[model samples]
Target: MRSKIYNAPCERESVRLLRFAAATAALSALAVLAPATASALPAEKKPSPSVVDVHDSELTDKQIRDFWTPERVKEALRNPAKAPATRAARSRTATSPSPSPDLAASAPARGFAADAARSGANTAAGLSVSQEVPAGAGNNIVGKLIYVSPTGELTHCSAASIVSANKNTIWTAGHCVHEGDGSGEAGWSKYVMYYPGYSRGADPVGEWTAARLHAPTAWTQDGDAYEADIAAVVLNPRLDGNLEDVVGYAFGYLFTENRTDYAGAAVMGYPAEGYQRSDLDGERLMYCAGDTTDAFPLNPFDDRIKLDCDMGRGVSGGAFVWGPQNDPRIVGAASHVALDDAGQRVSDDLFSSEHGSYAAALINTVNNEG
Candidate 1:
C-alpha cells in the first residue's frame, strides 16, 4: 500500500487543501494547470505558485461551518497547513507523446486544490455523441458519493448517467468514491460512498446504499493513479424510475467506445449545491470543446479531451457528454489536472483506454449490483 495524505478544508487565509483529489486535487490537480512558474520565474525568484491577488470568492469559514454543520469544523482542524505538497511533475500511467521535459520536471506532486481548484468552475465544448434511454419510467442518470473522516465527518460528491436509463448506474471518477490515490483514502477518511441523484444531500428516490463500489483496482492501488482514476457504484436498490415514469435519461457514450470526433460535447450532472447542478437546467448543461488540450504532467499523453464547463463545489462527479444533437452521449469525464512545461495547472479529461479496463469493469459491477 502507498502512503496516503489526507487534506482538510480551507479555514485559513489560503485556499484550504482543495484536492486536484481522489484530487482528491482541485488545487492539487491545478498545481499543474497554471502556467509553469519555475522556468518563468527569474532564476532567483523563489519557485512557487505566485499568490497574485485575485477577486476570488472562497467559502467563508462561517459558510463552511454552516454548510457542513458539525463535521467540516473537524476537517478544517486536521488540515492546518497553508498548502500541502504537489508532485513536482504530473504522473501518468499510459503514454501520450512525451511532454516537453520543461513541463514534466515541475509538476506538483500533491497539495491543496486537489479538486483542481474548483468553485462551480466548469469548462466544456460543443460536440455530439450517442446515448440511449432504457425505455419507460425514469431513465435519468446521476452521480453520488460520501466523504467521511476517521474523525467521523461526512460530505458528498455528485455524478450523472450518460448511458441513458438503460442501467441504474452512474459514471464518475474513481476518487469520488474512495478518495483515489492522494487523499480520500487516508485513515482520517472513514468510508467513501456515492448516491445517484441525491439532491440537497438527500436521496430524492429511496436512499440506496452502495452494494459495491467498483473502480479500476489500479487506481485503487495506484497502477495509473490518475489515468484509470475512474469508478462506479452499484446501487443496492435498483433504479425504480425509468424514462416514461420519470423526466428522462441524460445522453452519453458507449462503454469503452472512444469517440475522438467529440469536438463539442456537453457535460452534465449535479454540482456542489446538488441536483441538476443548476437552478435552471440551462446552467447545468455545460458545453466544452473537442479541441481541448494543454500540457498536463500527471497524465501527459491526453488525446484531446479538455473543456471549460462551470460547476460549483458540490459538482464533483458529472458526465462530460458529447452534445445536444439528437442524442448526446458521454465521451469523457472531468478527472484531474495537468501541468505544462511552465508548471501551470489546468483541468484534464479521463476516458476509457488500454489501461482503462478497470473503468469498464466498474460499469459491469454496477450492472451486476443492479
Candidate 2:
C-alpha cells in the first residue's frame, strides 16, 4: 500500500525543549516511541562494498587524530561542505516509485540498536529548512563528520554511530568519503574524524578517527545514483573503548524496509546554511520530522525517500530514523538536496535512497571486513 505524505509542522517548543534537554543528558534515556517485533524473514545474499584503508600510508591513526586541532575543526565548520546535487523538479505530487523487482520480495525489514535491539523506522527546495538542535541538549550519537576532501578542502557533514560487531561503525553519505565514479584514489578523503555529541565547539565524547571507508560500487563506479549514495566507516578504537561504548549508545540499522513503512520519521544533522537562525553554524545538531514519499519525478526509477526539509549544506550524511525515540533505527542517510534551474536549493525538499539489499550488503561488508 502507498503511504500518504504529510507535512510535519515546525517542532513544537514544549516537545522540542524536552528532546533538547534529554538529548543533552543521554539520548538513550528517552523512551522508545513504540515496540518492535523481530523479523522472521531470511537474509538476502548481496555483493560486498568497496573498501579503502585510510591508514594505508605513513599516516598513522594518531597523526590523523592530531591533524584536527580545535583550530582546524573550527575552520572546517566555517566551510560547510555541499552535498552532490540533482536537477530540481517542480512537481510535489508525484507518486512513489516501486522497489526494484529483484529486491522487492527480499528479506523483511530488520534493525539492531546499540545493545542489539530491533525496531522499525523527504523534501523540497529553496535554501532547504531545518530546526536547530539546541547546543549541548544531548543526542550525542549524531554529530559532525570532519574530513579533508580530495581537493584539500576541510569540510564537515552529519554522521552517526551505528550498532556493529566491532562497535566502531558510523554511517554517512558516499560522497562524504569518495569523489564518485572515475575520480578514484584521488577522490578518497583524508583524516576523517567524527565528533559525537558535539556542541558549539564541545567534544563531549572526544574524537574518533576512521580506519577504513566503505561505499557501494554503484556509487564509486556509477556516479551519484541516489540508492548508492550511502557509505559506512570502520573506526579505530579510541583510548576509552568502541565508539558506541564511549558515546553511550549507537543507532540500530533498518534494512530492506519499504518507503511506505516510514510513515513518520525524524531526520537529524548539523546543517550549515539555509536557515534564518544565526545560531546554526553546522556545529549544532538540527532535525526535521515528517512523513516521507518516493523521489517521484526527480528520479522515478530509483525509489528514493522524500521529505519536506530545507536543511542545507553540511547536513548530507545525516541520519534518517524512525521507531522508539530512545532506540531509533536508521533507514537511510541524507544524500541530495534538490537544486532549481538557477542552481539554488529548493526551499523544502530532501531525498535519501531507500535502504534495501545494497545497503544491507554495504554495512555487512564493513562490519565483517573493515
Among the numbered candidates, top lDDT falls to 2
For residues 172-201, write the lDDT of model 1, one tens digit per residue: 555455433443234222233333344333
Point out where model 1 deviates above 4 Å.
1-140, 149-153, 162-166, 182-206, 223-226, 238-252, 255-261, 270-301, 310-313, 323-326, 338-356, 368-370
Report lDDT per candidate: 0.33, 0.59
Per-residue lDDT, model 1, residue 161, is 43
Model 1 global lDDT (CA atoms, 0 to 1): 0.33
For candidate 2, lDDT tens digit of each residue in 50-86? 3222323235688997898878988888887754432
User: Using TM-score as the measure, which candidate wins?
Assistant: 2
Cα-lDDT of candidate 2: 0.59
Angstrom error of the Cα, residue 18, model 1: value is 35
